[model samples]
Target: MAAKMKGAQILVECLKREGVEVAFGIPGGANLPTFDALYNSPIKVILTAHEQGAAHMADGYARATGKVGVCLATSGPGATNLVTGIATAFMDSIPVVAITGQVRTSVIGNDAFQEADTIGITRPITKHSYLVKDVRDMARVVREAFYIASTGRPGPVLIDLPVDSTVAETEFIYPEQINIRGYRIQASPLIDRAAIHRAAEAIAQSKQPIIYAGAGVIHGTAFAELLELAHKTHIPVTTSLLGLGGFPETDSLSLGMLGMHGFEYTNYAVAQCDLLIGIGARFDDRVTGKPDEFARRAKKIHVDVDPSSINKTVVVDYPIIGDVKQVLQELNRIVQAPDTRAWLATIQKMRQEYPLLYREKEKLLPQFIIQEISELTKGNAVVATGVGQHQMWTAQFYQFNRPRSMITSGGLGTMGFGLPAAIGAQFGRPDAVVWDIDGDGSFQMTTQELATASKHKLPIKVAIMNNQHHGMVRQWQDLFYQGRHAQSEINPVDFVRLAEAYGCVGIRVEKKDDVRPAIERAMAITDRPTVMDFVVEETEDCWPMIAPGKPHDQMLGTYETLKQAGGVPQHRRSDPDEEAKLSLG
Candidate 1:
């Protein structure tokens, strides 16, 4: 018997068929029917304080679970609120399905209230988007949205469902399969023996070779193969910002993050390497620095699922289009370890000579405080960071040992992402200790989320790296703009007092030695949320920066003039000779 159902009911059914167990969002007038339909379904709905928070939560969920994160919101303000989160997910290539309720189809073009053009607004950000005008097409549209979001270079997809359409009766027949004539996800077959042979040969011949992994490593679940490859080849590994947690940063072979704000040794190794094997990573601007000059000396073999990414910006010697897990497994079977002892020795020397420096002074520096907290927490706590200096420092210093241990807005780098995201992360892992590493500048942007955490009784430890200025922007000004600090300072508030007002346990730390005691005390008290305001040095900057539009190896900060000058490596700086070796183009 053919049964009739509301478009909203069909949407839920389609989602369920796609194995979506939970959706995060907030309800408003235009999206009432979708909320009503969710009441009877098995799919769980998590209500967030703001739509933007809900979208980010979904983005985080998708990043964590490797499934398409779904978020729902009403039209206009609600939909618009999800824009930042949506754009962030898009920039990161995270799989997310953003469903926004719209005004009635009849009034869509009539200047109605809460009637924003979500499709038009979100087109550039989302992988694809749709406007559901006909109720009968609801099931089909939803299925397509989920498919598109999960496949290829994954990203967010927006579906604007009109309120009137949600209630309209439609035949509910979930399609058994999806067929689109124009849409195709291209991937190479694993049976290509020649390509595999060449990749293996590339591995065996190079002396100074490293494996660079990205967020795609996590998405493709290639961590095991990556680890195996690293072990088999005895190669040092470095990751991009999104690539954190894909490998245990504490591992001896792990070089940590490599970028403008990455470790001194990591960026140096990228510059000096003769060969670079990038798995599940796009050579993005942040990672590559200058497209023409990035990895100039290294012969690169890029293994990614997306073909379009191959040699798009940076030149790739070998581009393998397949899932990273599959390609790495194949390469592992064919490749033998190159004698990298000399190479490893060089890297070790570089690491030992120019270690990540956090200056020790009478007053506290944020890095020292974060490192102390990390040590105190024993790497068990989940660190969530807002954008800028605090985020880079946390990524640099914190030894993330497990998957999803570090959550930050890496791709879009949305400031004020700390408090609400920390709350959402706490919910995701209720048993794990959660810490919000925020800068005072970024923290003030979403300080209101303190209320959300306190209201829900989420035991999130917020450690404000309370530098009274926007540290990252200030660093740029100091280095490139001749120290003319503009609009970076803010009248700092008493974060402890603010936390206290929100019914949270608060502590203030101004001295270097007080950091550990404060964190230990906060960790001991788990009954409510805790905030530790750490008054830190304001002028400190993230070093090893490859000046904007320069090569990845061309760092603006300290670099050795000679190969062993001060026992430091030469590739750490953006010398023209180093650029001549790496063939990015």
Candidate 2:
């Protein structure tokens, strides 16, 4: 006789079989059966204050662990809340499994209380989705969800379970593996050998060559392979926002980040290079700036698991439809060693000439403040950011040495992401330092999370970059709309005082020198969460910007913009311990 199992029990068993150790969600009536199933499960269930928080937490976890981050939610609002998070994970190609409850099967189309067609709502964002109409299919669907989520070009997948279905009885037999006929994740070994040889020849013959990398490296777990390739070829590398930590920022060849807010030298090098090798990066309008003018001087070699991404925006001379790690390994084996000293030297000179700079004035800029905090944290802390100028600044400045060290609402560009995400990151890693880097306008979106943090006694540090406006939108208005900063201004709040109301510590930094000291003090005080407010430069903008639809080479170089501002820090000062002067090549 076979043992009986509830739908939820079978779901848990399936997740366990898939090796999932954590599930993030908020409990509700529609999900009660599933929550009951989780009561005694080995997989840890982290309760987030909001469903959105649960989704982002799962996203951060996936990014850090290279596993499928799982999020659970009830019907209606709970399900809807996961949209932004799902979209974020999708845009970044992070693996996620979002499980949502639906109304009873009888009431699904009738629009019963708290009912929403989560599958339909999420169809556009998720890689795939399913609504389990049968209890017997639960285990198989769960298994397939994991397979789809973790396979090639990983992304978010959804499984919608109705409340009644969760209470239904079924035999619990977890499948050991999944075999989908139409889903083929593995790249074929029989790629165009001639094209590969041509790519190798181009690299060998080029006097200047660079690799433009994207989030694909992180998704494929190919960072080590990428490093090996870059080191072997002696090619300088630049990354997209999602591609942070794809290469070590501390490495000599790493050109920080590239795109709308990229390193000036990185953009210039792409423009000046004879050969441009793109690895897993999409030629996004922000990254490419002027697509027609991007890398105009260079011959392009594009390697990606998704063939559609090749030559979609920017034309490529050579295309390889293979996995990044596999393609790089093959290229390394086939390519002859070339004399790239001149190219490497040119990059080194550019790095020295136009390094990332945030000037050290009496008052510290938000970028400088975040970099200092990141440095002090030693890449061990998990930093979350709200979407805006500060988010871009954090991506540009923070030298993340570890995976999942930095979490922001990258895809959806959602405001109010930091506080809740920090809450999630802290819950996910209790011993790890967690900082919520937020802006005044964005912080208000989820300020209620401070109450949750206080209730849980989670010691999260909230850094408010108070610029008195919606900085990014304001930046756009300033650039294109003749400085019409309509509806962007927000009344400043005494963040320190606000934290007191939430039973947390709050410190205000009015001066530049006070930024680091405030952070140190907050780090020292471990009793409760703390909020620090910094008054940053109101007019400071992220440099090396690639105006929309522009090519990679047409980027706003630091010399023409950032250096001209005279506020960026130099990176090559004699005193390695202090802020370097900002320079323009």
Candidate 3:
């Protein structure tokens, strides 16, 4: 029998019924009733210092566990703080349900104390949003929020609850059946036979074909199907940054990450292919460079669950609107693959010629550190990254062997995303090794999350590439503005001390030799979190950069480092323990 309960109680009970065991959030005046409801609940609530961090934690948890992440925030300032993190999840198509408290329903539009327009503010970024004025609507809204967030083309969903409505009495009837009008949320589409056949025919006939996969492949849990398709056809695969772990990076068919900071050969393959099969990937500017010039030689075949994303950017010759897994499964059965021995030879030669190598000096290079970490973990660790140079280095260097292993802020490029995300991932996959590779500038943005992790006893590892500048911004200034680096130089902060203050074990590596040992030591610890501060090269820049509006083939620094190497040791620094003052990282 349904019993009388407050709306907040019904909301919590609904979440419990939805199988939410953990939540990340902060409590405030507007959410006191919900907090009171949560007091006796079985759910584990992690209170983060900032609402943004809480949102990211939820997103990371969602990505790692293949479930919707939940975060709570009070109205006004707290809700506003969640916007960036919400946008980040939305852009990446992560499943997250963000619940924000609002002012009393009676004073919602009167500009009451601690009131802001959360529904209006979040409408643009969320897949769907709700303004719950009626207390009875709470249970249904929570169910809808999770359903919308986790299905179709997964994205963030928002719920704005008035304080008064939440505290009001309601008959608790957690909806076992939901009927949302005009909204169909399912994994697979109504399979179109003709479109699948045509896509298959195009694949069979093409001499030079490339499979470009994206995050959708991960979301669909279709990596096996993707690998089967690739293996059966013997097609070389290249991935977007978000798609890194979608295909096995160590496989012979793998061409690594493709785009602005992508492997040069991968871009070449995408541009020169006779057939470009974009599976579950929107051709973002970073991938396409200039839409008009991108894949000019290819007859494009685009497959996506979202109809709007098809031909929204780069026009497609054949568009298939369906779940990527379902489409690939059908395609594999009906189609015949090709022998790309000649194509493989061509790509191999390009790969050998245009390798990703930096002009190394005595000082420790951030890229090398990432490579070492990858080797130590054997591509088994769940790695997350903050934006900028460190983020790029992690993508370029760390070879992910499985889907959902690499998590970063791809679409929104949110700074301070790494550490908090690592915390969330650790919670989601408690047995998996989780690491946050962060830039100094980005790490400081959510450094306070370390305290949260410490309190929860989450054994997350953080590696901060301390390159004393906003690395990516400084890189652009160095190249485009003729070295006029304004305000990019960051004020120095001792991250080691900061971590210690937050009750985390801290390690600092000033020498190239100490990086491996330090990382190993951190991995050995099982009781708490640890932060590694590596004071890396200050002037090193991420290369293979496609300047804005430029074509993929027109990246500026390609092959320059290879020419400079000439056959000597790739990295040569004056002293083993010297600072990274006069070297490339």
lDDT order, best first, reads 3, 1, 2
Model 3 C-alpha lDDT per residue in residues 325-352, reported as the tens digit of each score: 8988999898898767678777776776
lDDT value, residue 397 of candidate 2: 66
Model 1 regions more than 4 Å off:
40-42, 186-193, 559-585
**In angstroms, how far off is 363's CA in candidate 2?**
4.6
State the displacement of the C-alpha of residue 396, model 3, in Å, after optimal TM-score superposition: 0.6
lDDT of 1 by residue, 394-512 (tens): 88777776667777887789987777667766766678798989999888877876776787788899999888999998898887789998898878788888899989998999987
lDDT of 3: 0.88
Report the lDDT of model 2 for residue 101: 90
RMSD for each of the candidates: 5.3, 3.4, 5.3
- For candidate 3, list the clashing residue pairs, or say none: 362-573
Off by over 4 Å in 2: 187-195, 357-363, 551-557, 560-569, 572-585
Better of 1 and 3 by lDDT: 3
Query: Top lDDT: which candidate number?
Result: 3
Q: What lDDT, from 0 to 1, does candidate 2 have?
A: 0.80
